[model samples]
Structure formats: C-alpha cells, structure tokens
Target: MKYKIVNINDTGVRSVLIIYTGGTFGMIQDASGSLAPFNFGKVVDRVPELRQLDIKLTVISFPKPIDSSNIGIQDWKDMSYIIEENYAQYDAFVILHGTDTMAYSASMLSYMLEGLNKPIIFTGAQMPIGSIRSDARENLIAALEIASAHNNGNPIISEVCVYFNYLLLRGSRSQKLRSSTFAAFESENYPVLAEAGIEIEFNYAALKPHDENAQLNVINNLDANVTILKIFPGITEHSVKSILSDPQIKGVVLESFGSGNTMNFDWFIDCLIKAIEGGKIILNVSQCIGGEVEQGRYETSKKLNEIGVLSGGDITTEAAVTKMMFLLGSVEDVNEVKKKLTYSLAGEMDMMEE
Candidate 1:
C-alpha cells in the first residue's frame, strides 16, 4: 500500500513517525458541515504545536483513510507492515487511530510485533480536529512526546501503549469504556504506565521489560475464525449451541459472568462440553470490566475447568479475541494454541498462580 508522507519538524534530537490511520483525530468539517478525513498533508496547520516538540515529525497517512469501524485484519497487517519496514529508521511511532477500535488495534499489534524495543503509542480524539474544543491536539502532542521519550539511549516505553486524555495504558490492558468523552479509555486490571500532567510521570514499575538484542518479528497470519459468546441471565440453549456449533469457528472467547461463572444447567454444560470435544479451544474471560476469570473458584465455574475450558485471567475480551486469532493462525498446533492462550504472550494477561 502506498502512503503519503508529510514532514512536520525537520530538525530534532529524535525522529517520530506519525501513522495517520483514519480517525476523528484527523477530521474536519466541510462546507456542508459533515465531518470527514481531512487532507493529512496539512496536519501541521491543524496542530501547529507539533512544531514545538523537540522531535522530528514525519507522518505516513493511508492513501484512502477509513473509519475505525471498518478496521479489520487487513488493516492490522498494513499497520504492522509499515512498522516493520520502518523499524530501523525511526526511534518511535505514534498511531493516530479512532478511539472506538484503538484498543483492539493496539492489542492485536502487541501480539503481532514481538520483541519491540521502541514505543508504539496509539492516540485519537473524541471530536474532530476542526472543533475549537477538540482534544486532538493534546492527545497527539502527548503521544508524540511519549513516543520519543528516552533515557541514556534507551526508549522509556518499549511496548505497545494507548495514550488518551491524560493516561498512558498498556495496549492489551486498555478498553474503550466511554463513548462521548475525551477520557474514553482505561486499563481496569492493570496500572497506568504513565500520566501526562505538568510532565509525563511514568510508572517505571509498570513498564514491560524489553530485550534490546531481540529483533521485531511481525506475525501477519491472523485467523479471523474466532468469535465471542457472552453469557447473559436469560441466554438460551439455542444461542449457546448455535455459537459453539459453528463449523468455521476455531476459537471462542466465552465472556462468562463474573469470575467466569456460567449457568449450571445441563444444556449449557453440554454445549460447552460438545464444543470442547469438537476441538474448539474456548477461552473463559470475565465479562466484568475489572475482575478476572477464576474458572474453578466456584461450583458454577468448576464445570468449565473440568471440561478443559481455558481461563483468561483478567484479560480484556479485545485482547483474548486477538490473541486467539494470533495463536490460531500463527501456530500450527492446536495444543500449542491452547497452551499459549492461558499464558501472557505479550504481557496481555496476568500469570495464574500455580
């Protein structure tokens, strides 16, 4: 895919590549007063403060920007490809994506790009950049600064992260919890990696360790034959059966009630058992925003453990789904996929205490 590059700041200590993926961050209104992707070539004109950052800025925008709602596996591949091709040239990357699916993209990239040693900060806005009160300028500026931040020649943030509002969260741990506010993302089960205020206060203890010797490996083969089945109070047997019985589905992210509890009804257990027997790797993740999936902590969830349903401890559904896709497509062995599903591949989940 061809990209249009726009140079913002030419001289600085560090260079940051701003990936302009279609989002509200680069939007403006037309004469008809409808929001659309603006000509990102003039991004410097919209957010002039970029000139003030001490980092050389270059933007690579998609030839035809798309809404985050339309982002799919191909988009993820494109983003990864861009990073892989430019890995050695740039010190950091700032991805301007729509907040709606920014968490998903970030989580997916965390798994796809292994052994990353530079910051890949994802940021977006709640309103168009054309709006007088839009948060786009602040978010972009902070993200760029955080991306270029380093100490003694080592990058401060060496993993995928989402910088929104004033919080910097691990990409895999973040979820878009709000729809209409600038504070649209949160990491309920993990600590904020950094906070932007008078200055960026980084939680060094929360940052993921990086291996400087390791090279970036981009895994592009993602299997999309995975789906989520959320259990509700009155979820029907038919619903369970239909979802589990899909022939094309290879993995299922079971969004179980608090702490992985599910109905103990014979039909429900039978459906789960049947799915497991059919060689479907089911990952049990909690539906709650802040809790974990304790597969056998209670009698309600004990059956899941007995049936070989894997526990996704404190993992967001977005991460669980993308992890499944990453494992299923990249790993040829189903047993290996099941093993990796329960472990933290890219610091996506907490390690279960044995």
Candidate 2:
C-alpha cells in the first residue's frame, strides 16, 4: 500500500488518515464485470468530493483487504496497531469497513483503545463506488469531514463512532439492521451524535468531549474462546450440554427468548449449573432487537438467574461478543469476568436503575 501527501487550500485544516480495510465501499467491477476488492488508494480520483473538504487527506490500504465475514481477532489487532502507531502524527482517523461486521469492529475498537481523545470514525456503503447510484461517496466524504471537524482547537468527537446514511452513532451502540437500503445501520438505544443535512447539525451534549491530557493506549490481546447460544423452541438439552462442556470454550452468550425467558426443564438448569460451576462465564441477553434482558422476572428466567447467568441489558449481539472478548482479555479471574460482564465498561450495556 502506497501513500502520498495531498494538500488542501482551506486554512485551519488538519491531516486525517483514512484506513481502508476491504468492504463493498472499495469494490470495483473487473473485466468479467464481477465485483471484487480494489486498491482503496485509488478512491480519491473516483470520488472528487474529498477534494472539496478543507482537511488534508492521506490514504492507507490493508496489504490484503479482508471480507467482513472473515474478520477475526487478528484483524482487530492489526487495525488497532495502525492507529496506536500513528496516534500522535494525525489529527484524527477514519476506517472504511464492511457493514456486515462494522458494529463489531467499532465496538471492539472502542474497548481496545482506552483514554482515546481523538476521533476514530468508521464508515462504509452498501453499494460499490463504481455503481451509478453509490452511497459510498457521501459516507466516505462526510466521515472525513467529521473526523477533521474541530472546535476550540480540539476534535469535536473524541470517541469511536460510526457514520452512515445521515447519522453519527456511538460505535458500541450501533448495529447493521438493513441490507438493501442506504440507511443500513441503527443505534437502538442511543441518539445520534450528529446528523448531516443541508448543514451538519451536531448535538453538542451527545458528543464525547476530548480529554487533552489522556494518552491513547491499545489492548491488543483478544481471547476468542467464546460462544453464542441462541435459544429457540424445541432446543434440546443434549445440544446445550455439548456446547457448555466443550473444554476450549470459556464464555457463552445465551440469547434467551424475549426478555430472557428460557425452558424451565430440570436438565437445562442442571447443565447451566454445571457450566457455571466449571468456571464458564454465561451471559443472558434478550433476543428482541430493542429490549433489555430481565433474568429474574419469570420462573423460567429465574432459573437462569439462580444458576449464575449474567444479564446483558439492552446490548446488541455485536457489542456482547466484543465485550466478552474484551473482558476475557483484561481479567484473569473467572469470577471477575462474570462481574464485569454485568457492568458497563465502555457503555456497551444500559443498566436499569433499581
């Protein structure tokens, strides 16, 4: 990947680095007319809107851009290392990622980069840039503008965020909900930090303010020994037991039926109890797209609570998985990991007040 310095005429401009990590936004048609990943460094020529922005821009492409479906812990580490290594040299950072796992990457990056006082904006498009009606140009251009936006000589947004369609959302709180529409992501429980219209209207109170004195630190080690158990009607105990008893599995996300309800069978309770006793961390999250998990309200869910399943209130699946990995990496004791799962470390979960 080659990078060149591009100059802008507007004054008060700062440099922002756009890191391209393979996605639909960077895809182009080949000779056979099949969509394939293209070198992102060539995007500037295709989308001239970038030149309209006052900020100086630089591009960095992953040596081997990966499809979002194939993204893993190693990819997360690689992206974090780039930001960590270049934190001081740039004013802010923008990442072009696939929408399929954009929320997961954004959430993981939020936890991995602690005390970060610079903007880390993640954006992508559902359609390729070469298409006639591509949403890529606006998303990419606006992301750069948001990343470079400053107030009182400080970056306006100091936290990790996702910019898509016309809204800016907290990275950890967003999820990709649509497949064919221009508005492909949503922040279920949180409000938009900023909205782009004729003019960008920033909700001042919603933005994460910069803490100039804080030093950026990256948590590179992520544990992948976690599993998700999504509950459905007629789920068998044998299937559940096999997953829990797996020697390599260290954490489990139990996606319970609406509001964290589960089958109250004796064998089901016994399997969960044995798993908890064996030091496996179990977290109960609601299956509904917009509700919080309430584990002790019903008889079925009460069994889950009694057996030591932690409740994940109003957390998206993407946030839950990354949070589990984050906790698994930071904590050494199994008890501590369980406790932290219930607690909101990066504002990933909304805890109901007593």
Candidate 3:
C-alpha cells in the first residue's frame, strides 16, 4: 500500500525546517540531458502528499547542493551551524541528504549536537523524487511526521537519527546495508527506536529523553587526523609498521577479524605498542557486521587487550570515525579521550554483560 501524509489542522500543528543539501532526492532531468537539483520550493508543490501532512515546512537549500559522496567534516560543521542558528525557530529539523554518506553525516551530527532536546531526522531517497516510482515521497513525509511527533508537549526523540523505509534508527548505529533496496539502512547493534507501519510504534524506553533545562551545545570542531587499519591474513609487517609510525596521525581504528582477532606476530604487536606509547589512540573494532569487539576473548586478541587498545563493541565504522574525531577535538588529555571512547556516549555501544 502507498503511504500518504494525513493532514491535521488542530492546534498541535508543527513547524519544521527542511534543509535540502542536494542528492538524488532533489534531482530532476534538465533540458541538457543531465540531472540537477531543482528548486525545492517548486519541487515540494509537485508532491501532493506533503500538503496532506498539514505541517509548516520551510525549505532552506544550500547555495549549491552537494552530493553525499563529497560530504566532509566541514559539511557536518555547517549543518550543525544551521541547526544551532535556528534552534528555537523550528519544532524539528529534516535534513534531505544523500544516502552514500548519510550514515556518516548522521553519526557525526549525533555527536556534534550533544544534549539535544529536539528531533533531527536525516533522510534521503534511493531514487529521484521526480520519478514515477520514487521512494522519496514516503521517506520524506514519514521523516517529517517523525520529527514533528511529540508526547505531553515535548518532542519524542531528542537525538540525531536516520529514518528510512519504515524504521527510525539511532544515527550512530545505522549503516547502509543495500545499494538497491528501499530498506537501505540497518542498525545492527541497536533496535529500532521507532517504526512506521499502519501506525507509528515508538519504543519509548529506547528513545533518548529530552532535558529542556540543559542548554543546547553544538560541537563544531572535529579533528580528522585519524586512520582506519583493516587487518588481513597475509598483511606485511612493513605495511603495519608504516601506518603506526605516521607522525601526524593521532588515532587508529583497527578493523580486526571475528571477535577482534588479529595476527599473533610479535612485530605486529610491537608496532601497536610503540604507536600507543607515542600517544596515538588505537581502538579495536570487529570486522563483522553485527558483533562486539572482544579483545581478550581469543589468544590472538589478548595482546591487544594487554597493550590497552580500546574496545569498540559492535559500533559501526561511521560511528567509530566520528566518535574519535569528536573526542579528539574536544579533549586535550589523551588518557581522558581513551576513557570516553570505551564509554557509551549517545547510545553508540552496547554494554557488555558480565
């Protein structure tokens, strides 16, 4: 069944700001035989479904919308700035972003907007919204609805999240799982915070509560001096040594094998040890799509645990990168940064059961 937005003209009408940051969702075929972003103000009128929602939506397009692939740390800062500048003016925010880097952007925003008390829903389409069979309309309409949904005069979700298909996932835990399917993202470690079926079902316990008294803080400074090292069966000592020896690098994410297992070679262990001693923060994250990083669970990973490599239990790569950046940017003390990496900030990690 096709999803349609239901209009509500009661006193509870919500006002939302839709930031169009260019993606397939806003593209249309131009006369020159190329796809370009049309004005969203005009684009919205074509979608009759939007009017049904009865919410006041304000479209704020970027000077030139960027593809999600080109999104970088600066883009994240800009998005945060926009929200911070207009925080009290809108009830919720809906970011129309591209799917390629949407998860990463969402995760970064989750950290940037710490202590958030309003809904920030990031969503985009697999197909262009102008297409006859586009997934854009449903995704956009539902995202706005979710953003506007409140309980007892307060917003339901107070954290950054991605709404795709029918599920609302914590941004830090979401990953794009499919290239072709409409159900493109999955939160492997965390359950759905909310689901949109015949009726929107919200797991209230799973939702991040709002603290109205806490002042909203926006963290824009992000350090990108981080590297990701993936371990392989026949990786050479030279490759591992070189990566660890980089003088400018501040952090490393070791994507080890199942259960965070790595090579038991002495040289490999020594390289990691030296890097850590040189003030480089190293975190061990599992290569598996849906498992925790147990550094000491196996003989191969025991050395990593002994040497004080941080454990990233079931956190996605997107979250690992942004979390490192956020921590590195905010804290000058390396030891304190290491401690926070292991802690569950913003529901990014699952607590290991004793």
The clash number for model 3 is: 0
Q: In terms of TM-score, which candidate is strongest? A: 1
Q: Where does the lowest 10-residue lDDT sum fall in candidate 3?
A: 1-10
Report the C-alpha displacement of residue 76, candidate 2, in angstroms.
0.4
lDDT of 3 by residue, 222-292 (tens): 89999999999899999998899999999999999998999999889999999999999998888888988
lDDT of 2 by residue, 1-354 (tens): 333323332343698888888889988899999999876766767787777777777787788777888889988988898899889888999999999999999999999998899999999999999898999999988888889888999999999999999899999999999998999999878878999988888988877667899888898778999999987888898899889999888899989888889898888889889988888898888878887888888878987877788889888888999989988977788777777778776667776321
Per-candidate TM equals 0.98, 0.95, 0.94
Ranking by lDDT: 1, 3, 2
lDDT of 1: 0.92
- Local distance difference test scores for all models: 0.92, 0.86, 0.87
**Global CA lDDT of candidate 3, please?**
0.87
Candidate with top lDDT is 1
Q: Between which residue pairs do clashes occur in model 1?
A: none
TM-score of 3: 0.94
Give stretches of model 1 more than 4 Å off.
352-354
Worst window of 10 by summed lDDT in candidate 2: 1-10
Candidate 3 at residue 173, lDDT? 92
